[model samples]
Target: MSDTLKHLLHPKFLHMTLFGFSAGIPYFLIFSSLSLWLDQVGVEKSAITYFSWAALGYSFKYLWSPLVDRLPIPYLTRKMGQRRAWLLCIQLLIMVAISLMAMTDPASSVSALTQMALAVTLLGFSAATQDILIDAWRIEASTDKDIAMLSSVYTVGYRLGMLTSGAGALYIAAYLGTSMDQYNYFAWKISYLSMAATMLIGIGTTLWIKEPKKAAALVHQTSDYLAVVGVFIICVTVLILSYQLTADFFQSFRNQLFAWSQNRPLSATLTTASQLLLALCLATITARLVATTRWVNTDMIKDVYWSPVKDLFLRHRQHIWLLVGIICLYRISDIVMGVTANLFYQFKGFDLDEIASIVKTFGLFMTIGGGILGGFLVVRYGIMRIMIIAAVLSAATNLLFMMMVNMEKSLVFLTFMISADNLSQGMALTAFVGFLSLLVNRQFTAVQYAMFSSVMTLFPKILGGYSGGMVEQMGYANFYLMTAVIGIPVVLMLLYARKNQVFEFDQQSDQKTSPH
Candidate 1:
């Protein structure tokens, strides 16, 4: 076996893989599995599609990651290490949240949807928080040369987790719910309970693994409290104001929209798109305003909040926005497609058993192979080079689903199409994760990573929420093609970044220490 192959199988990969599994399991339980559940339970498809917004928690996790890095749970911090303790606490919350979801029935009452959304949000928030710690831990654990190996196994493990959680849960629910009573709420509850129990994978890993020793201590002075409070109040204020503005605009736009389209599909899409754009604009403006505002607490707040931005700006210089733009657009095509994929499978006449067996199980192995190959390619040829290829292939694969449209649901055809799609996705995701990992500064790893992950997710999730409307308007064939076309810009931007020296793919982990 080659050194790359050897590195991939190193025993150390086990821990990262387990944590990756833990991360993947909850993610799909909240996302794809829940989508399947809600759709079967008679929730409106659009409403179920909108539930993807609950996952925006992952995008915003950076907002609190600084706290996770800076503070520790009172007693838990002493009993367990900082990252480990946070892992345990968050895992406990996830278990409880999943259990709560299991007990609630979306068909039970009017608030069933709301309850499900809240539960999903809670699960997502907890899971995203866990991710913050795990990413930091993984980076800290590996040497620069081995990061790719770790990244690949993490991808592999996460995909396997998805296979089990997504397919396994579907099968378990199907088999257990043979009786037809209000859409088999009882079986779903047990499946959720099973998901809750899977938290043990993370909990056990946290206990067994050693905390990274180089982790920094939070610097604090009594005067810093003022800055912290100022940041808290200002950030909260900005969010409140932005939300109010978005709500008013949404309502006003709705009233005026009928002049253009009576069905309101176009109006709804524009409104959703506008709200996302407005939120992004407000956030950027808030960052700028906070950075420039001169107050007694300026230095303190900047250190606490804007340090990551300053570090990145110094590295990227004037090209920061271009870099941000690329990251924002990179993963969106697949993500948006993912939001409505299960529904599409159903609409195309595949039953739950077929979806579970084929899409989830067969595609899982293809993804693992693609992800591992992606990791090896990154180690050998460098990231930017492989990312260019992966990006192109990733975009192209979405076109496969277009062929499934209005055709008979042949398992053979679905298998070949999805296998190709999953393979490309695995490669793209592995490269993407490694790419982000490289950019993180050890000093602000949690926050900067959260920021990057958030930027990557926010637009996609928001736009994906409107997918039901998009498909209703354009139909799946056009919508899938549109997703493929959207990915073209990523390839162009990457080539430009490489030419301009904004993209760095040749780093062996030696993480930069922040200048004190």
Candidate 2:
């Protein structure tokens, strides 16, 4: 290994890889193992897919990331500092949740298993929380000079963690006699418990690493944001619940006032309108009450939560819509096309072993290499230029898969198409991430970046969820062609944005250019 790589192995820095491993484990456990286990127990494939929604915690983590950034655990905050405290607190929660998920019987009722699967959601939630803090620690612990190395090591570690959980879990389960028609509950129980045991990796790393120097500063700023948000949400929920009362009361009044006409359709309309008016009145009154009420340490409710997001929109009001539009479109082709990759492989007649060998094992390394190359390409050609190229390539790669399905399901052909697709995705990921990095204001780094990222995925995921239906209707080739056609708009938008200079230097660059 190179000395820099070797340095990553040092005791002090080893935690990055450990953290990555920790992050990667839950991913496959929630998706792959859970799916496999459910299938083994004769759960409907559709139901299994629905449970995948449990992983949506990762997607919506940003909604609560602001609180993660600003809130501190009561006791741990005092002892371990902000980042470490949150990391450790959530780590234990995740561990406990995973352990509960492990103990859940596959023989349980669907509702019972679903409730147990919610434990996986909690696990995902805790893992996302840990990720936010880990990211904070990575930046604050390393100098700007070493950020690259830390990122590389952390990514390498994360991928390794994924591989271990995914392939490693399968191998372990097989050994436990849960493989190939065994649906062995005890065996799976043992295997899941085994997975839970591995969380000590994160626990050890959390305790081993020193809290970043800036932890105290972060905690101070995050002061009481959690309490304030909690109270606000509760007040809002209560006010919403108040609508039920108003609606009921208004319905009763309307019925009494128009008893003779109560059987008429017009009377029904009148009741609805009257109830809506009453609800509005009650809501307005409640709003005034909340505004006037001095609830628990109102001083801690600083503008930090919404300020960064508000500032971005206000400053870019001229072209913010256009910029956000480009972000949504850029990855639509890649994500939508990916939705059918496995189905395409199956359609092409590849067996599970062959698919796993080439697509899972070999494709992973190709993706990593592509990501590394993409990073270098971003350095050589600026992110905008490389991103445009990646967008184009991403759009074009769908054609390869479209062509592959017409063939005799050759492994060589499948490998080639998958490799090309993975490369394009890896390159686009790096460049797109760089592009997002350019958009964020450091003042609201967590919130701004999360907002950008969450929005970026939302459109793609929503659109991609329908891809199976698209394939069903149009067949693989036509579906892919449609996906490719969608990419043209993204290309046009990027080109226009470049022409008009819609986005150039973001907050970081502006800070550098500012007068001292």
Candidate 3:
């Protein structure tokens, strides 16, 4: 067998895909599939969009990633090592959270919706934590020679997991008789319960794998672990109090914007911006709380919280803001468009079964193809070149959706749209993820990568929360046009960075050190 085939078949690499799959499941469940559930239950468009905030835990997960990098579970850590122990523990939490979500009926009452949203928040938080540990483990397990391949495998697994939660869940729901005209809560409940069962794949993999060298070597005392846990608890308490205190102010502010603002776009923009700012403020308060505590004096705390930021700024001070801009905006167009995509399809008169088969199942293969092609192009032409193409493709494809608005709902036309859209999505995400991974400092892999990932998704998700409102006010054609137009900024930023050679040095360094 060829060397590439050998590596693909390796057990270590196969397990990495499973880890990626596990991480991918909850993300779509919370973001994509859950939106369909809310819509079918007769939830208002704006309310469904607001429900998107339940996944904000993903945007702020960097806050607690440091703890995952070093914190140890009591008995589990001793038995299976830190990373695996955390993996198993978080997997169980996800299972419980998902099961709870399945049991709640969002259509029951406003209070029930609120409770269901909280359950989603818990699930999102657990899934985000799982991502942190799994990333660290993936990095720790690979040598420099194969990290890229391992990352690709992980991406494949992650996409496959998306397939399950995205298409598989829809198939189940449709089979059990949930449609736009009729709301079958039992259908959705059974679908989610089945999705929850798939968490077993991750739990089994966690138990089957051995701890990597770096993860195994990360040993801390009982007192230090307890102190870190205390610090985490304090931060959580501060975040909760901060949100509760400011919730009314933000709500009133949003109300005023919608009530008085003449320009609808401006109103939507201000509302989303204010909510993003609130999230950032909460994270800042948590950070400040951590710093002011006695734990700040501890070496572990210093290394975890301060050192990563310091190292990143020190290394890239001149280009740090530009890099941040790129990371923050790179995926904005795709995410914002995706937030309302299923709703848009349903509005266009497609049923759940049709959407599941074409958009999810068929689109899955196209995306995987694009991802593989993207990985190859990045290898041949470098990330900057491929990323530019990916960006352009991503922005340009939204125009197809715009055209689809005018055309009749032919399966052929829908298939063509899905092909173009998912291809761009797959390519853009593959390049973007690889770019982020390349920028991470190995010393702070978990924390720094988490920070990068968190920042990248933060603004996009914030904007996505207003997507339904945008659709409500601007209409579908304009929304798709706006999504496309926003990609201009990302392209401009990439061009500026390329002109200034911001990442040239890092790429050179990686190439020089990597084995050929």
Q: Pick the candidate with the highest lDDT.
A: 3
Error of 3 at 115 (Å): 0.9
- Tens-place lDDT digits, model 2, residues 1-516: 497667556664577768877887787677666766676677644345445445556555666677767677788878877677778788888778878887888567866686676687678767766766666565556553344445545655665665666556665666667644566777667667777777788888888888765542543344356455655455546644665567667677667766875443344445554654455466557544664556434444335545766878887888988878887788889776765565566456664456556775676566656666776665544566667888899999888877876777688887888688867776776667567655666566666666676677666755564555456557788988898999899898888776666775433333444476
What count of clashes does model 1 give? 1
Q: How close is candidate 1 to the true structure, as a TM-score?
A: 0.88
TM per model?
Answer: 0.88, 0.74, 0.91
lDDT of 3 by residue, 212-293 (tens): 7776345456576567667667766665666667767877877788688666555655765665567557766776667576
Task: Provide the RMSD of all predictions against the true structure, rounded to 1 decimal.
Answer: 5.0, 8.7, 3.2
lDDT of 1 by residue, 1-516 (tens): 597677667666999999988888887887788888888877766778878887888988877777777675678777777888888899899899899999898878878777887798888888889888888888887887887778989998899889988888888888876222337888888888997888888889888888778554556653454445465557656754686667886878866885667867677667766775676677668766775655435565567568988898898777888779878998988899999999898788887778889989999889999999999888776777678888898889888888789688799999998898999899988988888888888778777888898899988888899998888889999999999999999899888875655655443211222133
On TM-score, the leading prediction is: 3
lDDT measured at residue 511 in model 3 versus the true structure, 0 to 100? 67
The CA lDDT of each predicted structure is: 0.81, 0.66, 0.83
* Counted clashes in each candidate structure: 1, 1, 0
